[model samples]
Target: MESLRELFKIGFGPSSSHTMGPQRAASKIKEQYPNASRFEVELYGSLALTGKGHLTDYIIKQTLGKQTIVRFKSDRLPYHPNGMKFYVYQDEEILDTITAYSIGGGTVEYEGSKLQQTKQIYPHKNLKEIIQYIEDNGISFYDYVLNYEDEHFKAYLFEVLDSMFTCVQNGLHHEGVIPGRLQLKRVAKSMYQQAINTRRESDRERLLVSSYAYAVSEENACGNKIVTAPTCGASGILPAVLFYCYKQLEIPRKELIKALAVAGLFGNVIKHNATISGADGGCQAEVGSACAMAAAAYGWILELNNSLIEYAAEMGLEHNLGLTCDPVGGYVQIPCIERNGFGALRAIDAASYAKQLGYLRKNKVSFDSIVNVMKETGKDLNSAYKETSLGGLAKEFGLKDGD
Candidate 1:
């Protein structure tokens, strides 16, 4: 598996696969063909279907030159849904053409090339292998992560943590409708204020956690800087949970960072064994994987056993198995933003349930089994349900470009 740094990325996001991935690809191509007079870019599948709402074309043009031409195609590449072709022209003649795929989580893969060419950091391929390694070594998840990841990874996580906090703070203070056709008014500020005024502790916790999730999700919807716990569309889950632990539970910075390591391990396992791209596996891959990661982090913070932590993570993804990536108006607002709050709440519920049920009995379903099921379920889903914005809520509410 690749490093956690690849799993957790910092960037502007309405959609990672749509905006961040295309931007990165365009920037790289711009560097390679600096003297080229113009460029042509073609977006396929989900990128084309939702490019305008997700700011894919805008980012590409911003990265390359304003003269860049972008075309949208309905056909998809067999390699991945978020696919693109770049044509470089110097004098009305093609200098080069490159095919690439944005394989989710803001990562790109060239034709016939691996998603990431960097050296593999961990030997385990799946959760089963990871569990065996943990048992054999008699080490905690934190120790296992530290053993494989270098010091630089820890420093990078700190930066990610800071960025997440900053995003939440910014969201809570800002009061305006998010930039999109939806005209959705920002609710995080009101939610947080409501949380502060609440009398009951339980309601306070719920509102606070939900507000944090909304804060980050709204920030992402507005194309602000945020960390992708796995991907931009489902970016709010883990941060909301972790921030709640830090502020509400009073957990220290070191412990939260360690929890992040454990969370990344869970997310990496899912990303390797299955998928994390909404365009590939629907919202199940994005929100589900993020919920699992957040659950694992919460379990780690609570000092749960490995089995309990795995159970919590399993439940997180299992409950969200068939969640569709049907963003209304092709923007990462509406269902996408609200789902973050629900996902964070579900993660907390999953972790707490695991901790409370620790002495009852062992869970029959392993996280690995659920991951396999999710992958198969995603394969069976229609393309319309997988980030194309052609079905579900996107279709139910008839809204258009200016509506």
Candidate 2:
């Protein structure tokens, strides 16, 4: 597995795959051909289907300049759903062509063996191996991460956490309709206000967590800056849980940072073993993985054992299986934002369940097994449900109101 730095990318959202990945690819191509007069990009499959709503073309143009031509092709490349072919031009002559795959979480892989391998930080690639390593070393999961990661990782995580907190704060302060045809009203401020006024402690806690989640998700949907917890689409879940622990439960900042490390370790395992791209694995890969990451982090905050933490992570993904990437109108609104709120609640519930029941019964299905299942399920999902926006909620209601 690579460093947590790759897993948690800080960038302007709405999408990591559609926006961040393509933007990165375009920037790289432009740098490689600095003398090129113009650029042409052809988006394929999921990228083409939802590119307009996700601002894929907008970012590419922003990166490659106004002369860049962006085309949408429904057919997919053999490599990935979020695939693109770039053509560099100088004086109306094609200089070179490059094909790249946005393999989720803002990670891009170029064709023809162009991707350079980063040093693998962790020897263990799956949850079972990770747990065994921790058990043998008599260390916590975060310690296992620290054993492989450089000392600079602590400062990096502090920056990531700071970015997350800033996004949440910014969202809570901004109040207006989100920038989309849907005109979705920003609900985070209202929700946070309601959370502050709620009489029931339990309800207040739930509202606070959900408001934080919504705050981040809303910010992402508005093309605001946010950290990808696993992906931009699912960015809200982990921060929601961790922020709740920090503010409501009064967990120390150092402890919360440790929890972030633990969460990143689990997220790395999932990314290594399965897929975190919604276009590749449906919403399960994005939101489900984020939920699992948050659950594991919450379990760590509660000081649960490895078995219980794994249980919490497993339940988080298991319940979210078959969740489709059905963002209505190809925009990361509607189900996307609401799903983050629910995913946050579910993460907390999963950790609480593991805390209460993990001792009575061992988890039959491991987190590793669930990741495998998730990968297989993502493969089984139809292309329409895999962020193409051809089916599911996107298709059914996409043109009904003409948003």
Give all candidates' CA lDDT scores: 0.91, 0.91
- RMSD values, in order shown: 1.5, 1.5
| Colliding residue pairs in candidate 2 | none
Q: Would you list the clashing residue pairs of candidate 1?
A: none
lDDT string for model 1 (202-253, tens) is 9999999999999999999999999998999899999999999989999988
| Backbone clashes, each candidate | 0, 0
Against the true structure, candidate 1 has what lDDT?
0.91
